[model samples]
Target chain A: MEPQNAREKRDAAVEARVHLIVFRLGEEEYGVRIDQVKEVTITPEITRMPKTPSFIKGVSNIRGDIIAIMDLEERFNITSAARDSRHTYTLVMEAKDYTMGFIVKEVPQSLSLPLSSLDKAPSFVQDFNISENFIEGIGKYENRLIIVLDIFKILTSDEIMELKS
Target chain B: MKSREQEYKEIFVAEALEYYDALSRHISELEKTPEDEQILAEIFRLLHNLKANAKAIGYLVIADVSHKLETAFGMIRNKELSFSDEVVTVLFDGIDMLGELISNVDGAKEIEPSPALLRNLDIIINTQTDNNTELNKVQKYYTSKNLSLSDLIYIQIKKLDHLLNLVGELIIDRDRIVSISKELDNDDLKNVSAHLYRITEELQYSVMDARLVNVGSLFNKFPRIVRDIAVAEKKEINLEISGQDIQIDRNILQIITDSLLHLMRNAISHGIEKADVRKKNKKTPQGNIELSAQNDRDTVILRLKDDGKGIDQQEVRKAIVQKGFLNADAVSDLRDTEVLSFLFEPGFSLAKEVTEVSGRGVGLDVVKNAIDSIGGRIKVDSKKGVGTTFTLYLPTSIAVKGALLCQVEENFYAIPLMHTDSVLSLPTEKLHEVGNLLVTDIKGETITVVHMRELFNNDLDTYNGTKTALEGDVQNIIIVTYNNRKLGLIVDKLLRQQDIVIKSLSRPVNTIDIYAGVTLLGSGKVCLVLDVAAITRYFIARR
Candidate 1:
């Protein structure tokens, strides 16, 4: 019976092990799943596409492959530097069959934490949210709120089809 | 693997498609009317704009191509280069290449322009520079003429659409005053209400008028299309456009451009006979195709009339029969006008052999579909060996107001009064079943009655007791006309008529096409606006 309880405890620990990649946009801390993140790099040249949604910055060529870059400031409806040099960074992610780059204010740091740390996002987030689809959950770390993002939901299938079309 | 960068790339791809379309038209026009300085200036402006934007976005391939086009235009403007048929042809080829590049941008496959094409472009650029002496003279001439050409500003249509939507909401808010006034009884309040009403009316009218733009902007490109087709067909044709100042909604104008282009091509390729044939027929040696636009009541009537050998009824009838759209017996009964209308039927083409211009079997049918998609009707009038005039009657605006309110399943729906012909009361005894369709007689006319519940797919019986109380003594029957046929719609009641702003349903609620849009009533509750024609078509198709 003692061996059986030990096995259950091991399984529980495995379930609790969840990793998040945290990033900053202005002053806010945001986190996405570690598996969803492909890479992080300094800002690169972005080729502008005419007549795109306002949030889309343009396309970028990264390591010989063409990828689209979306302005995180615009996507999050935040007011940041229109084009800042020192604060610029690119978050490379793979979601919804697209390899895209997210232009954020700074580099992201990977964090390994227990799933029990996450809690439901406050009602205020839903009321004033620009886009709630990509948000998975929220967690508190060091007196700051980390917005967990569902990268899969951010790059939706419909958006992929729209791009293809 | 999709990333944020890929999202931006897609945006670029969508924008590139629009720019390419403009570029192609500009190039095609330049080919035929190279001497038109204004057209050349426009071309230069468009290319320069594309290059600047492409560079800003980091689209190196587009930037490179546009840069070359801009340089070529710059040389032309300077008089260093003169227009040639070969040059224009090369420009057209370049435009086509641009279109391919844009299409590839969104595709999963890697995009690379043909090496041969790039080499050819480089050679053309080098050749232009070699002839800089002539280019300098051209530039001097342009300066002497006092023509100042600048790059065009590129704005997305969505931004304009969003602005219009906000204006529409403002108009709706202005109308809400009427509902508020109904609850007040004071004399001062009455005086203020009257003033508010007048101001709101003026605001609504002016805002709507602001959205109206001259269709000529779109029509201007067609002359070049006609000229190209005429040269290819070895025919002498003169194209005339009148009433260029007639205005319509910009949204409707864009949809009509493709249809009009197809029709214009058809006229040049198939409608107009060869120069010799035209001379033999006692018509002008140069066949004339006149496109005229005018307003008739609330409808905008656009006519494309060509002085050519009219549609041969027998040939059309034969094609109709071959296509199986009509039986032999039906063909025999059809009038010449009716037979001519068969050209608009899908997959029906009378051309003996397919031509590059139009014989793709989709031209006329596409015109019909385009017109129908915007709730417009196409009418054909033809005289044997004389001419054919295709008249299109379309509503000037898709954003309709002054709707007739009707109740169905305890909910009220607004049906645009323009589409609602007449309302009649159906006596219980007169309503009889005719081949599973309820029929009612109105002044010797037999009208088919479509139950509102079934049409909207509402879960309520035709004569539910609760509906009777709301309806009162009169059994409401709305008579609506679709494609010249009258259909009687049975409703629970006829509510008060008001000018309500139409709002589009969100994607989730728009699966059913019966509701053209949704609008908020005075009480702020959302009510669906029934698209009467779409509903009729749905019923007919289902049947």
Candidate 2:
């Protein structure tokens, strides 16, 4: 009986790892662990801080606290689509020790898939060089390569320190 | 629609309060020096303006009182009545009653002046007939003194605030030229920049000067506060005020009033020793508390000092432990500055018992919070059994100039340069991973690294798509300090630095809290400005 309970616990842990928050950026959809997402909000006024990395959009006041906003289009080397009044949404996620904002092309949707279902990207993917540090693995979903993100590796220690400060 | 009416009422209330405040000061000045024709004329004009505004607003009771006050002032203006201490006192009494009526206008309760106050007013009017000769003599005396009565006008504080704000916007516009010149890289641009710089500097100075108001307007209420608090505490205290002519922003002046009043009350109740104690300590029986303001560099330093037994550090330490705020081990390592700061901690009090006066333990914390909310710092210097002095250092203006704009993922943010510490270009080689966390050393301080892209949950593909690193020599890092804690943020680009006029984000955007305000750059693109303090608090709370 104890062994069966232990197996159930292991299964639950495995189940929790399957779901991801997937969102569109430029023309591509990317996924991050669902657990890291805080909330989605409308893009707000982003105050620029001096001497930050080029990809950081700036910072915004969220409620009474300030949170950093990052420009995914710039980070991913994609040309920003012409901003219509309704173009972007702010995806708030807990990264490192702070809540930061990401500008995305569209609102994100959540999806669930077993970890075993994910397949490694083929070596021939053209954009693999720039995304090498960011993508953990690619999963086949609806005949598309859904890049799974390894968020922890996206920024260096100094960059993280800069945002934290 | 309901909110609109409420907003109008608020405006009316604010206007009414200004009239009351002016009336109080004018009446006090008249009482002190009754022969000053200029002051009398000023008082008359204020009453007339109040009467007109009250009638326009349909506040009939206030209008009626204002009309009567105007009539009374007119009699003095025409030399039909004499200036006397008794008459001045009656005028001050009427002003006080008007203040109460104005303050209570929004409340459901109806307030009426006391019978005694009414009787005094009647006496003042009745005395005018017999005092006609004395009035003539006083008018002759004033004429001999060559004092001319100046017509008075009442300017709404809101209008003044608006004017100041417009000036602030102009300053930003002027600052943008400097940035524009840097981008153009031409002789014509340089000439235009030099020309814009001079004109803007002059305009900035003149506009800043316009916002400068004499601090006496704030100090006038303190004497009454000290009197009330001293009487309540059964203490003998004399309040000394200096540098009343020193000018500061009206907005800042308004904010500091309540905080200053609280400090004065605290001084009377806790800082000023009792008469017996003072005598025993070889000090004067009547304690003296001095409140002074002076300009120090670009900051205004207001100091409140009292000669009394200073704060007991031991008691503060014990209070910290008693409140369960700190453990024994932490207490042992605490410095005096840290202990002093514990007074600002919410719900921490050293008072033995809650008193109707100062011992409630809420006053100091509120004072500290008020000062901090305005980006001001408060320092408490106390010598045990000697005295205590609280010095507040505040920026001369709340309006900021140019802000540094940076991008994280695709979102833009601005940081006010006034509060900005420094910006560094982070080298990848210096980044180190500690366990699962990234850390970096900056100026000998170990700082945590935050990934801009991940924190905002930006789609990795968009980030990767924009991964073209600028052909820059090094990656940039922005270091910002909010409340003394430093944060370093990494961003994708260092865009053009320009002066952007901060426009407050409306409604839903405001609710987000991370953005302080929005501004339009030279190209008229709206950008979000970051609230550094809010971001810092958010980071700390999440950590």
Candidate 3:
């Protein structure tokens, strides 16, 4: 018992079911670990970067922080929902080494569920025209499947390095 | 051992190493002046914690050893014992014992210094300060051996980076506030914003200062290096070093370490003539290499000057002609400095005859490329039969770069000023077409000129659709060059030059190699900082 307690204290167990913040990316619901999010903010004036792929919505100031904005619709290859660009929402997330923001259609409520409830994504779901590795699992929440996104996997090493630059 | 104990041991080792570093640094300092009450105090304070840490970790042997060393350092601090060379030597011996014992505490190696060494140290400690003659001898010996100016608590490098990132954001906001305040024109707001601006500037400077480390960290290793090289090369080489106090950003120093080492080796092996040859040339038998650094304007100037066989420019010019980089007539009109730059041309010295002709070894070009990558400049100036000096101008900080802001269409961009040699505004008639590219003469040498719209591939529909210019239309040419390849970047309008704080673009945006990083402008606009080298490479490659 003593040794078990010592080991437990040394390596604190990582919680299996992380609190996830659900958001809409062009009508489809997606969930990212809540701890990975720094804050959710209204979209500021985004400065479009030239010579970058269309998925990169460019950069914007969040509070005092300059965060790179990623267009979720373009990244997921979903046609963007017709909405006012002026009233867009930005979900500021903590990437591996830096903080960035993703332009979301709307930030829904946060949800918590057991890890057992999440099923492995179907092979057809993997056929989505995006980075397949980004989707960790498909979890049922409120009569809808929130695709649990592996926030870390969304950006490759080179992309992370480039962003951190 | 339990994993918990193992964790403790890992931390112990890291902290112990830092304490050990402090011990060596302070000891070296005491050696220089053989005095300094604060350095002594610091040494004692450092060991107290180290002793405590070792005791806590059950490494009582280390604790006992350090306790004794701490007592010695404490005695020296209070002048209870005369700070003598014998005393410092004893302390250093104690330090070495402590290092070895601490390193093996994880059961890697069960090793400790002999007990007699500690007893011998005690004997040195007990030695009375009798005669001034002996004391002076010890002091004089240390005063000669000492060379260097040398961190604190081991905060995670991630934490330091996080702090820097926060400070970077504050700097951008500060620029915004100052600009907005001017536009506001409210008396109280103006006064308050002015105060905020000053505070922000001071904070930025303080954060940058914290990140800076003395270059002496790199320079301190040179004495040993030079000594080793001198022995190996069988040459009587005298390496004189000064300016062990100049500081630079830690990151810049890390990148330059290998390149600087390469340059020194090049100087030793290829630049310096042997003692016998030196005597025949009516020079001193011992070759002299002076490594010095000084702050020139805003740039840190490091000079590695050697008294040896200077670079043969005629050979370099001949190699250039042979490489077909230039024809014979074109090479003949070039200055010595201009011709000598070809020595840094990649594969220039790879050939057997070229090495025999130029009389230099391989990889000089690698040195130049490394320097260029870091936005630093390296210049070589040599006189025939005299000697050569390789001067490197490194920026004070890489975080903040001086950039020339320009507007292409609606968006603004910043071209790093380090890449801009100069700017030219000339009529269209002066520029001529060369095959598929446009070229202009800069001091009789052909320079490829690229226009903004065309370079961007007319991505944004230029209201003026053509790449061609009207008869009297002025061309805004920013001359950017690297490794003798020059390009004239023709932008639509020249904005003001500013000391821009570079913010790295995230992920996919950063994949665009032509843009170095992003800078938040005073008007709340994020402008991309152009990587001049990349732009030149892209345009040249496109051809």
Candidate 4:
């Protein structure tokens, strides 16, 4: 009975897979879940927001909500483009109680990868300044490696506090 | 499946509290007039409702308790048992037990009725069975045909708050439309804009009206609190309330509930004197305490007055000195009003010993803090050996305000009209240089001039100096009073006055206290509503 129960547990583990929404930050491609993507649109004019980290570009007036726009390149250690550049789109993402925008170089696309295709992020890839907790196991799609982003773990509570304070 | 049960239990608990409050109210009425058939029937109906609700929720223990109480009430309804205080008190205890049983459904596990409580309820039943007339006395309540149409509907507060938020957004859009129509200068667009403005204004008023709640609902609870304290303290006191019809925002009422509780407790614990002391002082042994509310303009004034021993400034002074809060020399120059304000200072309890009721001096400051949080002020007045009255002044609503628009450089800021005294163009030549600061004379009073540019202190550097009002020789000054002192805010222009919906600055923006909140101006630009009191205090402290 014990051996059979262990075999079922292994089967469940093998079946675990994460569906993600992949987007580009400069030359790098990253993936967050499609579930958390509320909208994808051209980055509009943003208000000059203060009391936040430099990674926070500004606030976007979407409908009536004043959502913060986080610059993904600056957040993930890629050199930032000029904020007013046209080569950018915003992904309105949600995780638990928080909802904010992520500015990426390309429009996000949805995809799913099985657990068998995923592997631990290479030590060099994890060397970015961003918190490694948000870097889920990496996978390859169409011969291009995609880094999975854990939406809930991307920004630490302390970082959110800085944006609010 | 397990989590579903947890959600149901939460619903049952919330509903049970409302039912319990209704039961307690109806039962209290029945106690006073036990022979009133209507009151008895109402109490029975309330119990029956509780029983059926508990049974449906699978809280069988609570249902059993309610059933037992319902049966006893049925016997009384048949005119079999004589109305007595002993019976009323016993049933009140039973109701209390039922309350405990309802609270015990914490969603963690199934619970059973206490065997001891069941036996106690059984004993009451057996004692009353001797006079039982018939077993078929299920009292029929007032029929549906006899029901009066109640105009009141209770919605969850969150719904109204959400509606208010959407209305706020609509108002912002309306202002943007008005600005656009004025720019286009088209008669057709202007006509539509005028109609839209009128309808939008009416909607704002109607929504605020829906949120208004009568102060009486809160004041009604005070009599019971006073009665319980009076009985416990062995004192004879009467609480006479007037202006129970005064209505204010329900949010403000809920915020001040704890403050009122503290004040009432203090009234009984310290404000009212003992019977012997009253007799020795050649006064009536029975004391009178009045709780009243009156509306003044857009503000509500709640005054709780007790004709007990008024506060003694000498005793309070000693406490302040003893607490080492002030030096003896410093305390000597304090006025009676200033000394009275000291009672609200923390660590200054007048009660010599800790009592369950109050008097540790910890609560008075809490009362002041609570009132302040609701954008209200509390003032205490007492004449030694006569009486003490604490008056609370609260706003009708905190969401919207009529404000005077003012410009500092190019930026627009709002000053609440309630605090604005008068706007004047003071000639800079007439302004006397008192040391390093500017001062002016208005109506034979010295007013400190505060430069908005300097007071706001370049917090929003990007928006700095876009519009300057100080280009002329004369400075535009708005006279305002805070903490009995007058200060003048120097601005470049004074725009038209209008009602603006204020939104609280959530974070980083709130760190700058110069602005009370953020509002969208008629031109669609975000404006900060100034906190006059804070600016006044900050200027004075700097001086």
List each candidate's DockQ score.
0.02, 0.03, 0.19, 0.09
Deviating ranges (above 4 Å) for candidate 1: A1-165, B1-158, B184-200, B275-282, B312-352, B373-375, B425-432, B439-447, B457-476
Model 2 stretches with alpha carbons more than 4 Å out:
A1-165, B1-153, B185-194, B359-361, B401-503, B512-543
By summed lDDT, which 10 consecutive residues of candidate 2 chain B come out lowest? Answer: B135-144
Best by TM-score: 3
* Alpha-carbon deviation at B524 in model 3, angstroms: 2.6
Model 2 residue B152 lDDT score: 37
Compose the digit string of candidate 1's lDDT tens values, residues B1-543: 355466446656666666677777776777777777888888788777777767867878878887887787777778766667545555565666666665655469765765555555555567745633221111111112222222234556676677667666655555555566666667787678778778766765665575677778777887888889899888888999997868788888889888888888888888899988888889889989999999976688899999888888777788877887768996786656556766765666777778877787675777877887676777788777998888888778765566789877667778877567888776666666665566677887666677665544432223222232223444678898654456788887788787767775432223345666666665544556777766665443332
Give candidate 2's error at residue B191 in angstroms.
4.3
For B507-534, candidate 3 gives per-residue lDDT tens digits of 5455666777788898888787888777
Question: What is the DockQ score, from 0 to 1, of model 2?
Answer: 0.03
lDDT tens per residue, model 4, B118-236: 65556556665544432222121211122122223469988988888778888988998999999999999999999999998888778877788879889988888889999888888
**Candidate 2 on B1-543: residue-level lDDT in tens?**
245356446666677777777777887887778778898888888888878877877788888777767777888878776766656666766777777677777689787656566656655666745544231111111112222222234578788667667766665555556667778888898898788778866766666665667677788778888888888888888889987767777777778778888777777888888999889999999888888989876678898999988898888888777888777776766667657766766676666655576776565778866775666667788878888898887666666545788876555667776456788787666766554334578877766555554544533223221223322445577777644456666667767565555666432224444556776554334567777666555553332
* lDDT, residue B59, candidate 4: 77
Worst ten in a row by lDDT for model 4 chain B: B138-147
Error of 3 at A99 (Å): 3.4
Q: Interface RMSD (C-alpha) of each candidate?
A: 17.5, 11.6, 5.3, 5.0
Candidates in descending DockQ order: 3, 4, 2, 1
